[model samples]
Target: MLIEVEDDFRSSSDKAYEKIFDMILTGQLKPGEKLIRRKLAEKTGVSTIPVMEALLRLEALGIVESIPYRGSRVVPITKEKVRDWYALREAIECQVMRIITRTLTEDEIADLEKLANKLDAMEQAGDTEGEEFWELHFEMHMIMARKTGHQSLIDSLHRINLFRLLQRAQYSATEHKNQIPKDNHHCLIDALRTRDPLIAEEVMREHIYHSDSMI
Candidate 1:
């Protein structure tokens, strides 16, 4: 994520936690893959103690789990779990978009357009840097939610951001990802511009559904 802390706000364990979390969320570590703390320490250039600390945090977050006799591993993503998370995310995000549509300013619209264009540019370059795109795209959605002036909703969205990005990344190179990202952004922008809460919520709901299905 953003490692630009003026001071090191993250501890060694926190850094290890974030690294492992990133791998798990991006499907790099892969669901159900065993996490060997020693190997992870060597790979990440940290100590096994910190890796252990990180794994514990991950377990609490439901991103990793221990098998009692088999050590720990990344949690497998199940269809049911995806559906449940989407149900929660969609409900929260749609409400945020509805509020945003009624109160967004011209400057905010321009900022969103820039973020969407950046995602498009990254995709068009054939980099398939889904991780980069995923983070930025997630931030754009959070920005929209935050602009709604609801701290509670923003806090809720923060907790689900990584999980949602994991699901969204599954849409990359799917059977029909073409223009879906760009088009979704365009539709969202239009809704905001028109100050149409109905349209904004509808478009956001549809977009999230399509992305979730790809997962």
Candidate 2:
């Protein structure tokens, strides 16, 4: 009986965490917005315990910060922070490119090419800010990372919640539309096809810096 209750509590906490995480990523919960436990509990339709647990988890991930007496608030997005994330992403993903250059199968390359084409089409349509666009963008990157067969790299990216960082960067840099080339992802795939780690790393660096320049 106790184990079942524990499982129920864990399930509720996971749901609350996912809901709150999505809210943050989708910009429904803006940076610096205070998270009231009672309000979140009511919103998530869960008890305060689960909501609190979710907030604590987010806090650990650097997405939320608790003030001494002010409760918790979403971490504010800033150019400096975004740049830091960009640098971290570049470091991790450049290595991903280097590793996958030697190991990525032809089928994997084709899959990546398909996703790149979709991303290019979305860019041409000027639909970059939509949730669907960002989701696909995240998926594309995750596919590359997964192709490297590096669990640690995958976990690092997930731990940092790179998708949320990308969304926050995009939201903060609304003035920088059309800065990224529509063929950016296609170019990346071409670099990967070269099977030269150095070439792939250089392309990856340029790709990441394009987004970093926006902020």
In order of appearance, the predictions have TM-scores of: 0.73, 0.85
- The deviation in Å at residue 83 for candidate 1 is 2.0
Model 1 lDDT tens row, 27-101? 678876999999899877789998998899777656678998999998766788778778888999999988988
Tell how far residue 173 is off in model 2, in angstroms. Answer: 4.8
Candidate 2 structure quality by residue, lDDT tens digits, 190-211: 9989999999999999998887
Candidate number achieving the greatest lDDT relative to the actual structure:
2
With a 3 Å backbone cut-off (N, CA, C), the pairs that clash in candidate 1 are none
**RMSD, each candidate, Å?**
3.8, 5.0
lDDT (C-alpha) at residue 43 in model 1: 75
